[model samples]
Target: MERILEPELMDDEQHALAYAQADFVEVNRGFVDRFRTTFPDLTRSRVVDLGCGPADVPVRLARLLPALGVTAVDASAAMVRLAREAVQRAGLGASIRLVRARLPALPFASSTFDAVIANSLLHHLAEPGVFWHEVQRLGRPRAGVLVMDLCRPASPSHARDLVETYAGGESPLLKRDFYNSLRAAFTPAEVARQLARQLPQLTCRVVSDRHWVVSGRLP
Candidate 1:
């Protein structure tokens, strides 16, 4: 299937914004803990987060890794503006910097960051391969890419599990958004396939049921 250059504008931007505000605490815990455990050695390292949304993860990363300098980039101008405000609200105006850049073309030179993370942003992409290629281009050999997205269900039970977990106790709009994300998400196998085709030099793995952290050194 030919891919649309830009995926549909998020269905209900205001609702999405509201949902993020309400659900961010719950949604961020898993990713934050996972990152903390996964990258314990990081200190004063340069980290860049793509598709930073409201910059929640970057804000958290700044708090968690005070020695680490972070640059958060997002395609949405509104989101970047919100992210800037979020950083300011957190009193991290001195540390976390926000940039507006589309994912297809990261505004950094090759091998710029020690780590890169994109949370809940992959599913919105119409062409994950393009984004993956760009990610590789921006990272050094040892840089890591931590990606968290909905898991693709392989059977009825898996599907039911996801619906129950992600859609439970949410607004109608939130439930609908979760369901759409699952439908759009790539399976671990699919992620691996794309990695092989787009970033064969990288060591990529699905580190959790609903999380994939792809990392490796450049050959």
Candidate 2:
């Protein structure tokens, strides 16, 4: 399927709120759980979450590892705004730092974080190489990397089925966005090839029917 790029940043207030209010608790919890389970020895004091939409993953992770601090980065101003409130509501203001920065152009030095993670962030990018580059550039030596994202469907009918199944109750705008995301997402094999060229240390695999997970430690 040809990639149709959607708006890169979810900057609008009502739109961002629609995404923030979307019921992704289970999916978010799964991302956190899988990260912990896969990297059982991940004892990093500092971690970075790229494209932290609603701070759901960051909040859950911070609460799990009380000693761990998270730097949550998102390109959308409204996303960061809502995330601030969510973080405060969870009383995790001290544990998580929210930064409004566009992906592939983060304002951080090399090896700045002990670990890096992103959820459903890749499909939104037109230059995924930038994401891969920043993952290595910003991560500490052998920094743990955990990334999860939707997988592109084989056909339009399949994509529509997924939307109907998963986003049946979501608002029309949000549902359209979700469908566009699925259309833009890459398959596991495609992502693996990208990793091989830029970040051989990371491994990509299909983790669920709708998602692909790329994870490993920086070499």
- lDDT of all predictions: 0.71, 0.90
Off by over 4 Å in 1: 1-12, 24-27, 155-161, 201-209, 216-219
Candidate 2 local lDDT, 48-151, one digit each (tens): 99999889999999988888889999989899999999999999999999999997778889999888999989988888998999999999998899999998
Compare the candidates by lDDT and give the number of the best one: 2
User: In candidate 2, which residue ranges exceed 4 Å CA deviation?
Assistant: none
Residue 119 of model 2, lDDT score:
95
Query: Candidate 1 on 119-197: residue-level lDDT in tens?
Result: 8777788878887877778877767667676566565456557767756776766666665666667777777788788
How close is every model to the real structure, measured as TM-score? Answer: 0.84, 0.97
Question: Model 1 misses residue 31 by how many Å?
Answer: 2.3
RMSD for each of the candidates: 3.3, 1.1
Among the numbered candidates, top TM-score falls to 2
81 in model 1: Cα distance from truth in Å? 2.7
